[model samples]
Target: MCDQYRKSYRLGRRPGEQGPRPLSRNQDRVEKLATGTATTTTTKTKPTTDSSTANATTTNSSTANPSITILTTNPTTANSRKTNSTTVNPATVKAKDSSTTTKTITDPGRAKTRKPNQTTTNLTTANSATANSATTNSTTTNSVIVKTRDSVTTNTTGTSTRPARITNKSTITITKVPKCKTQKLKITKNTLTVGTWNVRTLWAAGKLDLLRHEMNRYRYDIIGISEVRWTGKREIPRGDFIWSGENSNHIRGVGILLSTKAKKSLMSYNPINSRIIMARFNATPFNVTIIHAYAPTSDSSEDDIETFYNCVEEAIEKVPKKDVIIITGDWNAKVGTDNTGWESVMGRYGYGSRNERGERLLEFAAEHNLFICNTRFQQTSNRKWTWESPDGIHKNMIDLVIVQKRWKTSVTNCRTFQGADISSDHSLVLCNIKLKLKNKPRHNQRYDVSQLKDQTTRQSYQARIEDNLKNIHSTCNLNEHAAQIEKAVKEALQATVTLEKTSKKSWIFDQTLDLTDKKRKAKQIKHLSADSIKEYKNLCNKVKNRHDRTKKSGYKINVKKLKKDYKLATAEKRTVW
Candidate 1:
């Protein structure tokens, strides 16, 4: 193609190729470099160069190298073109093609030095109606202005208009969705540090100070306090605590405190004899019962002891099989028995094997998959017994907490905070619990320990966390442990309930089991154990030795059996009495 330059001038000098001399007076600032391409443009408010400086058109492009050619222009000459203050109309440039690759340049002087990676783009100008007709190279090198016929045409008349405004834009959005998890949480730990002291009153006991302080130091979610001296008229000292079991058929006497935050779920209570209170709660994923049992010393009969076990068993049955259960209480009899033959509780309360009520209590728990919580914590059984007599000789823990099958893991850090010094002679106990928490870690944050390579970075992260914690000072007193814990648990339950609301299927509605927790209890019948068996044998021996002085007890049995048979044969409604 034949090229012609009509009225042109270079304000700045080009390198001398064996010429007379090169003037550099016009070099104030270098314009943007282009790849053998240039566009005539000027800011609407500011002009770039003088229009009258147009010099003579001189173009002699010679190529020394085989790859590139140089277009030389004489800088010292001048011409007629005078048009620098003119405005050109602007328009959006569109690309013309995508297939053929074009050479681009950053500087016009270095236009021949085409970079291999430069992508030349042809964008449409206002004068050119074709799509993206204007081309510019992206190479960051020197440039050369190929002044076109349009440049001279602009010089002819001041007719160009202003360009359109170039505006910029952006946007933002947010969304939320419900999700489900695949794995089920498990109760990996269980610990109970409970104390049952006969502290006269909670406030009166100096031990309460140690107990409360110790409890605050450690984290105890559940605690069973015997002889709390709670009048029942007064509210529970703690908002998160629930009471069960106490003086029965009587006034408020003793009770158990279950932690609402630390336990699974509390089901029901059995306040019998009007005093002994027993309430159950769920912790983590397990079910547990706290018993504030104050067995009457006046009624240590085999029947009474049997009734206690029966009541406990009934409560256990109400709980789900998958859930675990625990019971704590104060049994009046040491090594005593019931009407049937079985040992119940531990220790000897001046009672011989003839009636083993204590032994029976132990046996009942054993048969029903229960374990003594003290066995896992204290090294010595004597160390755990609460309520020592003034003389210290009567030291024994009739107060006890036992766990049902496989529920041991739910209890952790069981230890007595204090037992004797507190006002009522009862010591405070403290321990921590491991709740089966849901989504214990943050759901939104991303964790990357890899960046914590050095101590400085780790320290920085630690400092940030500590600062956040310090800023979130908790005003909630008393741990509110149970209440807050319950909230979390209830959230999960509520979610489940919501599913039930939306769906028609339910598995809990039709489930059935053969266990009858109520029938298992018989307060009127006396149970037995090994010691009780010995006592019965000894009784029989004594009756023989005093046969002449005593009415025939063997005959009494014969009559009793006959009466039972008679009732069965007649199909009569017979009360065992």
Candidate 2:
């Protein structure tokens, strides 16, 4: 027997007296036998190695079983069968209906085959079987067809006992979609406090500490300092101190100090010689550009004073017009209590009498459209004057705070603090302004180095360093070794040292502070009574005497130490020679 007939015998038929039937003949016989039946059955079979023989067997089985209307197997060709029907490839099948349509869809990994009859639609894959509608009785009308990859279900007027069976596994795939997200923002308000002060000198010991104390007392965000008396330009990250001074001598200098908040907002700074230093800050509504200028004193010649103002004007011109410009420091010019012709630049609440230098200041302000903030606010004589002569009898508001006329409203208040004592002739002049600033994060860690002044803490610090260094493994790479050394020292410091708590504490004696306070009160009341005046004079003398004694003592000690160090160095040099 042929292979096609042999497979048919195994499927439940004995190929007894008939050869394998042609696919066309089998389909015709199946239709004739199913003409009177109301039931339809579909059988799915496994594919044989011989594809052509498998298709022939599948067709013969449909005729053998009258109820089976559809037969499915793996994609195969039936050209070997002696049938007049057209050859059907694995991807395409055509029915006998004249209007039947066939479509084959090809995908990268999947195949789709479609077969259509005159009144029914059928869709199939190379490995799946699906039937939309099928009718066993030709008279049956409007049959409900339910198609699935695994089975074929039909709802009609007549019922059948046989159920369609599907033996092949179906594959299913599921896809997922994605979503989008949004962010929220927060709004806030902040304040900017600016000030100016002539510190006289930062060359003395404990001067910077005293300055920090006064700065904290007033809670200043940015402060311009004059007469820093430190040669060369340098930036100290601690408290954000930036200063510019004379190249060869500790004569005149200009500096600026920024608090934690202000330092974070600082964009840039330019040091123009010893008398002028300008800094810019990032702020809302507008940026802030401040020029800290230590103009020539009254004793200076006209040429010197003119040159100072000219330099200040050039600095002012360099600032962008959109920025809020503030020229503050010891201008050493007094634009007295008068606002007649200079009403645009000065107010009527000024201190002392105006001088020739003051006229120059007024002209500069008018030319630059700047408003003198010092004269804009009504303040007491004591609070308005920022400097006091040596005898405590003469006081003037030489230290001035000026701002752009357009942004004068931002300067809510401007005045001086007479109680802030830094052993300087000038008081701290502060200005309050409203501004929004961004909070910058800082990671630098600082320790209280002052603790090392004690012998016990010093020894403990040294021991901790030695232990930490001993624990580090030596490395050949210079960079790695340096990093390890730095880490070890930091760890040692953290173990043996304490964090600095506040910059408010000062080294000056409490007795001196009390005496200074008493002297301030005496000065405030000196004009009220003759006894008060006498007391003020006495207090002033005592304070001056105390300052002189302290200075002489410090100077003598410094000279003695220098002499001793020089002798020791000379003796060591001689011995070495």
The numbered model that scores best in TM-score is 2
Q: Which stretches in model 1 have alpha-carbon errors above 4 Å?
A: 1-214, 231-238, 244-252, 258-260, 263-273, 333-355, 376-382, 409-420, 426-577
**TM-scores of all models?**
0.35, 0.49
The lDDT per prediction is 0.37, 0.65
Q: Write the per-residue lDDT of candidate 1 for residues 121-185, one digit (tens) a residue.
A: 11111222222222222221222222221331111121122222112110000011112233333
Error of 2 at 455 (Å): 32
Model 2, residue 566: displacement in angstroms? 24
lDDT of 1: 0.37
In terms of lDDT, the poorest run of 10 residues in model 1 is 168-177
Please give the distance, in angstroms, between residue 87's alpha carbon in candidate 1 and its true position after superposition.
96
Q: Whose lDDT is greatest here? A: 2
Worst ten in a row by lDDT for model 2:
170-179
